[model samples]
Target: MSNIKIFSGSSHQDLSQKVAEHLGLELGKVVTKKFSNKETCVEIGESVRGEDVYIIQSGCGEINDNLMELLIMISACKIASASRVTAVIPCFPYARQDKKDKKSASRAPISAKLVANMLSVSGADHIITMDLHASQIQGFFDIPVDNLYAEPAVLQWIKEHVPDWKASIIVSPDAGGTERVTSITDCLNVEFALIHKVRKKANEIDRMVLVGDVKDRVAILIDDMADTCGTICHAADKLISAGANKVYAILTHGIFSGPAISRINNACFEAIVVTNSIPQEKNVKQSTKIQVIDISMFLAEAIRRTHNGESVSYLFNHVPL
Candidate 1:
């Protein structure tokens, strides 16, 4: 622990502070600012030479800028002779573009792969992130990547807050999240459902249909992220229409982009639970239906285990309940 140094970028300092507090250490002093030409400048306020440095920066709010800042910070730490630099990106940027889904389209770059390349080229020795949009994105990097799950925290929340949780059915907003939903249901020893979505075009959900029984039972929709809230909102509507007694959503990253707040506010969901992996916008913060779960302790424990050369696999299954 003495050789561990944690620093934060401008993206989500509050989360970084909380993580540092959990580890009983203060955040490392690093000055990050912008120049007249809109270029990012970073300077380490103290020496990190021969120390294991962890840079905390979530890929939220001004996505490109945050990515650039993280890359620069990693490069700076390496240049300063840090023993190792680990990028602790809570919300990985460009994760949705993990594949070239449209092969016929020209210039269809796998942006996630490019980001991984940038991190490696920028001198990152390790990568730690939560609930990536696509798990396969880990293969894009040659270095070690720790993909953490937020299911434990979410399951604990359900156990504490929801009455008759044992009777509730876990639901996947789309077939893509079947595995994620199944993992939760398996842990709770409950039944699960899946929603099949038809898309008219990109980002346009044409129709959604519930495949399993949710009738008169509490339904908890689980997904890795909720961007624009279209899938979540539409799935909730379908669940309710299919006779679900109540509908709720639990997403690891609440990306609430573009009309998401309005859609969420008008949805049939009882509550939209999300972790503080990405900071909520003003409208999301004000929404009464949205609930935030802090993941700082989970991340802090991972950092501790990594610094101590201990296995962090236990964190994947056990929640601090």
Candidate 2:
């Protein structure tokens, strides 16, 4: 642990601080600023020479600037003779842009791949991120990438907090999340349902068709990310309309941009749980239904194990209590 030096980018210093606290280490010093023209600059305050350097940055608010900051920070650490530099991006930027939108008949860049390429080019020896929008983004990187799951944390929260977890039915807000719902359902030995959504336009749902039974059960919506909360808020209503006794949501990355706060506040969700992959202080304050689960333990342990050359698979199943 002494050989490790963890730094943080501006995107999510709160989460980074928690990770540092869990590891019983102080965060490394680094100054990040912008030039008059808005270019990002980074200066490492202390030497990271011959140490395992981990820079904690999330792909959230002000994403482009944060991404550039991470790239520069990683490059700086490597240039300073750090043994290895890992970018611990809690929520990966441009993850939703992994592939081209087929049937749109227009050209679009695979921005996720572009981000991966940029990371490798920026001297990141390894990558650590959670709940990628598409799993294949791991293949986009040439370096060793650890795509950690928030499943155990979610499980812990449910088992400890939800009194009627036994009466709960896991639900996917959209077809893309069916696999996530299924995995959790299998773990809890519970029934799961899926919601098929028809989109009229970007970030707009035309209609959602609920499949399977949620009647009289506590329907828990599971999703990887919720940017505008449109899908989640609508899915909660659908669950209620399908005769669900109660509706809850669990998302790994709660980007919660635009009207997400107001929608959640006005929606029918008993609660919307999200990991601290991105800071939720403001969102939680604004919406009484929002709950944040601490995932810094898993992240801190991952960093420790990686530095010690130990396995990180145990985190996939063991509930972080």
Candidate 3:
């Protein structure tokens, strides 16, 4: 709409610029600074009174800082009397802790829920995010939320880049990602496979088990996020052992925490493709086989549709024909 205004925080500025470019508009001016005590300080340089504003801020590096910037931006829009505020977070922070894993630890799902509540309370009317760690986390928000999939984008890339067209097999590195892997498989009209892993000891390698034949086929592994390369590396090893000709990976968020890059480099995968949902770390940039597939176009279109009150479902129907 003519009343739409888009802004970006310190986080994911490049992706934000691409989104703004797609909409044929300039990013709204906003200054985000750090205080002497290392606290986040944000200031809106323009007015958005009676306007629908979308704030693009993904929680990547310095996750807490990015989170605070998004919160403060929302608060500023509310105080400026904007008609509506939408938080366009490609990577939602604190998503991994959606459920409590230890008896001694407090429930962090509530913490994740608190983030949604904070945004709503601070005047966020809508949310846009991609490939949440757990799909059930959507229930944490009462406001209208649009959870976009990177599948359309990933599938398009695969169809273009992968060598063999008809013999590709979608793979899930672990049983937990079966649904995600199947979605891609169905879209590509390809058969799918699943790899199972068992963690025998802490900080130790995991043993992998294969559920389907991967031999002499183009194996494609799909997962929502890759924090550590442990599971994926193990899965790749098993796929190789099972006589898989070559393996490729499509991961939504490439967190690449710790020595994940090194681990992935040593694995049997031909290439590890990831989206720019999370900013690529320094270590990731140094890797040769790690490819970054930009989802900026997909994200940009979603933001434009959201601003114009257009249907986002069409964005996922098929990759622009």
Candidate 4:
């Protein structure tokens, strides 16, 4: 660990700083600029020869720019003869296209695989990330990749923020999230419920059906990501209609792409908690019901452990009650 260096791209500079601080080191200097023609250029400011280098960049908005930055940084480090390069991505973008659900549609799992290949081909030694949209995305990488869970951080937030935990129940916004919500329920020693969503025809309203007793119980929705907040908002309305005492949600990444903020603001839930994998936009902060929890500390700790060859599995232990 004599020569461990961490560098951050423009996407999440704050998170990168937290990671550097947790490791008791200063972030390595680097300059990434875009040409007038819009091409990305990256330069390594310090020597990384024979050092273990980690680049922190989120594959969030401006995904292509951020992705290119990471790739170029890796290339720079490799050119400088770094002993190892590890890409630490908090949120993997374009991951929703992990498979081809429709005929004649090109699958973007290859896009994720291409990113992996870009890092590997550009001289990355390993990869560390968290809560991929799909688990099998790991299989696409030839190099060793470790995926961390956001549950630990989310669990802690719930314990501290949501009162009357013992009387709460976990709810999944859709069937796809049932297993994840179930895990949260088991960790908190609460019952689990799921909302069934059926997409009938194009431009038709999707019917939502509740699975378990949610009446008078605090309901917490759990999912990996929230793009538009449509699904969760609809589910929250159903839960409230079914007599739920209160409704809240915890999601890993808040892409907040389209009408996400407006929907979240007017949603039936009491509050929606999301991690700072991607920088929160201004409108998101204006909503009192939308709370942004900093996962910087969690990511920082993971970086520290990885640098010291310590076990990060402890992060997964004892989720909040």
In TM-score terms, which candidate is top?
Answer: 2
Model 4 residue pairs with clashes? none
lDDT of 2 by residue, 1-321 (tens): 678999999999999999999999999999999999999999999999999999999999999999999999999999999999999999999999888888565788899999999999999999998888999999999999998999988988899888999989999988888888899999999999999999988899999999999999999889999999999888888889889999989999999999988898899988899999999999888988899998899899999999999998888888444
Per-model lDDT: 0.91, 0.92, 0.83, 0.83
TM values, all candidates = 0.97, 0.98, 0.93, 0.93
Positional deviation of 148 in candidate 3, in angstroms?
0.5
lDDT of 3 at 201: 51
lDDT per residue (tens digit) for residues 129-166 in model 4: 88898888898889878788888777788899999978
- Going through the candidates in the order shown, the clash numbers are 0, 0, 0, 0
List candidate 2 segments past 4 Å from native.
Answer: none
For each of the candidates, the C-alpha root-mean-square deviation to the true structure, in angstroms, is 1.3, 1.0, 2.2, 2.5
Worst 10 residues of 1 by lDDT: 99-108
Selected candidate, larger TM-score, 1 vs 2: 2
Model 1 root mean square deviation, Cα atoms: 1.3
**Top lDDT model:** 2
